[model samples]
Every structure is written in C-alpha cells, then in structure tokens.
Target: MSLGDEPGYGDAPRGEDGGYGGTGQTRTRLPDRAGDVYGGARRGRSSSRSLVTVVGVVVLLIAAIAFANRGDDESAPGTGDSDKTKTAPTAASGEQPVQSTAGGIPAGFAHTGQGAQSAAANYAVALGSAEMFNKSKRDAILTAVIIPSRVAEFESSLDKAYTPGFNKNVGLNEDGSTPQGYTFVSRTTPIGTKLTSSSADHATVEVWCSGLLGLAGDNSTNPVTNGWFTITMKLEWTSGDWKIVTHSQKDGPTPVPGDDRASSADDMAKAVEEYGGFTYAR
Candidate 1:
C-alpha cells in the first residue's frame, strides 16, 4: 500500500499515469473474455474449440488475472527488423514513445523490436488490469490491443476462463465490481523486456513484471499481495501496429522480499485511490 517508500518501477515513464479505471468509454462488450487478463489464456490457431470443454481451463481465470499488471518505458516504434536473438533490457530507447492512443490505449507502435517490446509491456498492463473483469472495459481493451482477425478467439477463451464464479474468488462481485467496503487492487509493473525474436511482420517479446492483487480493506479476507512473473507474448505487425497474437506466463526471476513494513488496509486503500497507473508502456 505504501509504495511511496518502495522503489518505483524502473521502467515507468516520465509522462503522467492514470488511475484504476478504463477508457471511460465502453464501446462494445465482446462476450468473450478476450485476452485472459494477460494471465495467459491464448488464442491458439484452433478457432472452434470451446474453452469451456476443459473444466477450469484458461488456467484458473482469476488466479491468472491476479498474477500480473504495471509498466511504462519510453521509446518510439520503429520499422527495422531486430538482429537475431536481441534481448532488450529496461533502458530508455531515446526514441519518443508513442504519442497516439487507439480507443484510449497506446497505439502506432513502430514495426521495430523496441516498438514491439513497448506494445507488449503496455498490452500486458491492460490485459492484467482490474478493468478486464468488466465486460465492457475488457471488450474495448481487447479490441484495441488484439489482432483483429483473432479477437473473437481470444475473447472466447477468456469468456470461459473468467467466469462469474472466478470473479467472486478474487474478492470482486460476480459482476467484477468491488464489494461495498473493500478496494480491489490488480496491477502489473514491468521490470524489463527481452526481444526473443523478430522479423518484418512478427515478433515475440517477454515482459518481466511484478504485480499486486487482492482486496485492500480492514477485515478483508483477501488482503492485497504481490507476485513476480514473466509474460511472453507473440506479437504481429497488424493494422499498422503491433498487436498480441498469443501470450503465456511463467513464474519469475523474483528477488528476495524486502523487509519494508507493510502498509495498513486504510493506507493501502487510500494509495489505490490517490495514485494513478500507466497506459502507455514503452
């Protein structure tokens, strides 16, 4: 809760960060959960497959959703293909980060490797956010960041994965809303990005991130907690921008927990309300 005393995410941008909410414009509700909250329900090549066929499929929807969220790096999107096996660290790329926002999310990423990395970082934040539990917000976010051709596929998988029951388990109501007194906190902070591979039309980037999830309030059973993980997303150059193709997650690269004193529930709640999160991650 008292993240002020803790070290800020090194990759966060110098620009303004927004708070815990969506674009405020709910354009469409893609019935499909779409994008698995970046917890990694993938839109595989198989289209007709029912995500519901396998029980608890999509890898524990709520758990996956709670696993990750936060990053912002500064870099412009580019068009050059990266050399084989280029690993991009969390350093600033010197290029101006994307200045455009498509449907409220960052857009116009470069076709180059750093651009793809930036896209992946920001997309991970959107997908892993608390907003994903809301159908309208979730749909808008997916529409903005996913490959158009595969939007439905991702939605279907997430729809099955992020069910009403799963929502309740994460301390939210079945409708993905917080209870009367508690504040739900779900966010991801990217530590860095690595370009595993890249080409003219496609790229694969892995984001190293730290996430916070659970409910922040006194007597709340789900006290906020944090975790470390890496999200690997396959990206494609589509519609003049890099969008997610399919993504997956794995446990980290975690550092030893610090001995910082934990913040009280009230303090945590106040923090979540007062501070803002980032949308453009480079």
Candidate 2:
C-alpha cells in the first residue's frame, strides 16, 4: 500500500486493472478476505473497524436529512417547473442557466435551492471522472466547476498531480490522449444529496455516490475500476449561478457484490468506447 506504487487509478494500464480499495479516506477495519475488497462479513473484527462503519452510516443519514430540508427555505424555493423536474426524474437536476452554455453543455446555473444540489452532484461526477486523469479535460472541468478565486491554485496543484506519464499510465494515449477502440468510463451516481448550509450568496452540499473507473479493451491495462465515495462541496452563488468553492471526499460504507463473470478485455473496451456518458442526478 505504498503511495504512487499502488497499482491502478494513476498507474500503467492492464488488461483488467483489478479493483482496488477506494481512494478517498480509508476506514479503520479488518482487511478484506482474499480477493474481496469490501471485507466480507467475518465475525470477531476489531471495534475500531466497527466504529468506522458506524460513522460512515451516520454521515450518509445526515446527508439524506439535509436533502429533505433544502427547498423549504423561503429565499429561493425555486419555480414549480424546476422543482418538478428535480424530483420527478433524477436526470432533471442540473445547475445550468437558461442562457449560458459551454462546449454545447450547460454552463451557468441559476442561484436556487435545487441548483445547489444539482451543482453538487454534477461537480462530483466531473471531479471523479476519467477526464480528471488528462490535463486538458481536467482544466476544462476545473474551470467549469471551481469558484474563480480558487481556480488557479486548484488547477496548478492538480496539474502537478496529473502528470503526463501518470495520464498515460492510467490508460490515456501518449500526449495525454484518448485512444481509439477504448471507452474511458469514470462516472459517479449520487445516491442522494443534502444541503449542509446555504444563504443567498453561498451553499454547501454533500453527495453520496457509487462510481466506475476503467478502460475497456483486450490488451488494456487499468480495465474499469469501481468504488463508493462521498463528495462535500462548498459553493458560491456567483453571477446568478452556483460555482464550487472548495471540496473534499471520503470513502464508503460499500456493500459486497456477488461473484459474476468478469468480462473479457476486448468486450469491456468495445462497450466503453461505444457507450455514452450521462448527466447523473438523484
């Protein structure tokens, strides 16, 4: 469990980059059984591990409570149309303003209650995306989500972390490129969102998410990876829109999945390249 040397994530591609423990905050728990990353329910583990699980569950519950109370505030209750979309189909949530657009995607967002949650979820998706492994797309993402005051610092620091070799090792083409025949998928689905605090000027939202990270292909290294994480964001209602100010993440209370046929590298590669990504919401 050495730092940089730990395989996957930012390391060289593999035909199937076996799943590793989540990258955020690691919990204090008994190590998983052989080949099981989630630690199967074996009896007689240490109390510290049990305490970690309990804390994770409590944080999730708190986030749910916040989401339940958000729109009740009188300042920006949001219009019926937006509210309906936000709740009816999780897909309807997004902070995009009616006018501003970036790369033909929604750019600016209206400052409202729903907007904050939408911003949080979308930003979580972007921050955890495969694009974060590449310099250009990573820059675009930071510019799109981060508050202006912190953008430069954030970009510079992250630029250092996502080195060109690191990008290549993580399955990107040389020159921080995207290769043909492979679909890069690093996505997050927010189980829910909650507003920790808010005002007309700023808001903080937490999003609990499950994610996939991998490249699909026969000879591929770093074949898709998966994990559970929670993203907490501090946002500013800027120029009639919501922008992320600062953010942090922690690992999960993830459940164990049953054994299933692991797909071949070629099949994974084809599926990844052919499938399109979505704007996840909850």
RMSD of each: 22.4, 14.1
Q: Write the per-residue lDDT of candidate 1 for residues 80-152, one digit (tens) a residue.
A: 3232123334546667658899777788988888799889999988888888888888888999999999899
Cα lDDT over the full model 2: 0.70
Error in Å for residue 163 of model 2: 1.4
Residue-pair clashes, model 2: 14
- Each candidate's lDDT (Cα)? 0.77, 0.70
Candidate 2 residues 198-278, lDDT tens each?
888888888988988767765777777668888889999876668888888899857655334577777766666687665
Worst 10 residues of 2 by lDDT: 1-10
Candidate 2 regions exceeding 4 Å error are 1-100, 178-182, 280-282
